[model samples]
Target: MNVSIIKYNAGNVQSVLFALERIGINAVVTDNIDKLQTADKVIFPGVGEASSAMKYLKEKKLDEVIINLKQPVLGICLGMQLMCRFSEEGETNCLGIFDNNVKLFSADLKNTKVPQIGWNTIYDLKTNLYKNIIENEYMYFVHSYFAEISENTIAKTNYGLEYSSSLQKNNFYATQFHPEKSSDAGQKILENFIKI
Candidate 1:
């Protein structure tokens, strides 16, 4: 399969590449529009600020490329955040593949961390992304902002409050948690994505 990881100024591309390699899939990391467009599966993973990343996508015209892809596309973390309609981070507009807004974790929530790092259970799983995964499976997460529960939400997780941990709309899929870093279950999720 021609698996390609979208290359940009974001962090964690190498980790995603390594994870795919571990699964026996040698994914190409590239910003080339043709490679991305023609890949059987595309992984859009990012670990960075929203405004800057959006700026980069606009400059490279990747935003349009990603939106127009017909094959399955997987977005992780900030990539998922960027897929939403808007983000509270930097008050930026996003790709709008999913009609939802990303918001910052409110500080008023007691005994909860800003960037809900580490393992957290994801339930209400729906869609092929969770094929062999069960409800309440722990997934690694590290983010200060989160996408709200909407019609597209496929899986839900709770930290300070309930939110959409995973979402699917047409050919696009996304996860707020870092499946590449989530151990066995994480690998399973990646494997499922590849199969899709």
Candidate 2:
């Protein structure tokens, strides 16, 4: 299907590659502009800090390329954070695909841990990304920073507070949780994305 995974200075690309392999899709991981532009779909996956990741994207001019892709694009975790207007992490500016900001979780939450690791339920599902998935489906998450609920939020999750766990606008789709690590529900999300 000519699916392409955006290659950059970020973690999680290998795991994403393996996830796609599990689905029997042989996808290419590349930073080449042509490969990205011509792919049937593009997966922008990341597990890293926002500012540095944006720096690498800018250096490679991938930020521009990613913003212009007409084909459906999915951003996972940090990749989704970078797709927003700005990030509280290092106060970095981002791609502005989704008109929202990434903010750090409140430190005053006595009972909740920062990063909110492990499984969490995602509800308020919208978009094809969760086609066959039901409400309150648990997805793997590992992050302290989160995208705030906005007009673009397709799904919401709660930890210290409610936040946008998934977002969509036009061709861009994103998940704050790691669908690649979320088991069957995660696999369904990935399969839906591939279909898109």
Candidate 3:
């Protein structure tokens, strides 16, 4: 099967590529429209600032191409944030695949950090993406902004308060955490996505 990883000005593309390789899937990393449209599955992975990433996608016109894809699409980290309607990070408008909006974690929280980096448990599993994955399984996360729990939220996580860690709307699936870096459970989630 042809799996294409959307390449942009974002970080962590190589790590997602390698993660797919370990799962025995040889995927292409490209911004080419044809390559993306023809893939059996598309992975949109990002680890970067919101506005800049949105700028690059719009500049390449990939912003339009991504929303129109018929095949299953998986978005990671900032990719997930970009899929939302808007982001608080830079007051940027996003692709709007999901109805929810991304917001910055409050700095006024007593002890927790803004960007919740490191392992966190994901529960309330609600999509095929979490098939076979147990509740409260640890997943690696690194983000300052988060999507509020909405009708599209498929999984939930709590740092200071609860938020959508993963979301699904139609064929689009997204994770605020980096599954590629989450270890065995993460691999399973990726494999499950390939199967879908």
Per-residue CA lDDT of model 1 for 1-196, tens digit only, reads 8999999998698889999999999999999999999999999999999999999999999999999999999999999999999999999999999999999999888789787888999999998999989899999999999999999999999987999999999999999999999999999999999998
Error of 3 at 132 (Å): 0.8
Q: Compared with the true structure, what per-residue lDDT tens digits does model 2 show for residues 53-171? A: 99999999999999999999999999999999999998999999999999998878767888789999999999989998999999999998999999999999988789999999999
Ranking by TM-score: 1, 3, 2
Every model: Cα RMSD to truth: 0.6, 0.8, 0.7
Q: What are the runs in model 3 whose C-alpha is more than 4 Å off? A: none
Local accuracy of candidate 3 as per-residue lDDT tens digits, 5-33: 99899969889989999999999999999
Segments of candidate 1 deviating more than 4 angstroms? none
> Any residue pairs clashing in model 2, and if so which?
none
Global lDDT scores for all candidate models = 0.95, 0.94, 0.95
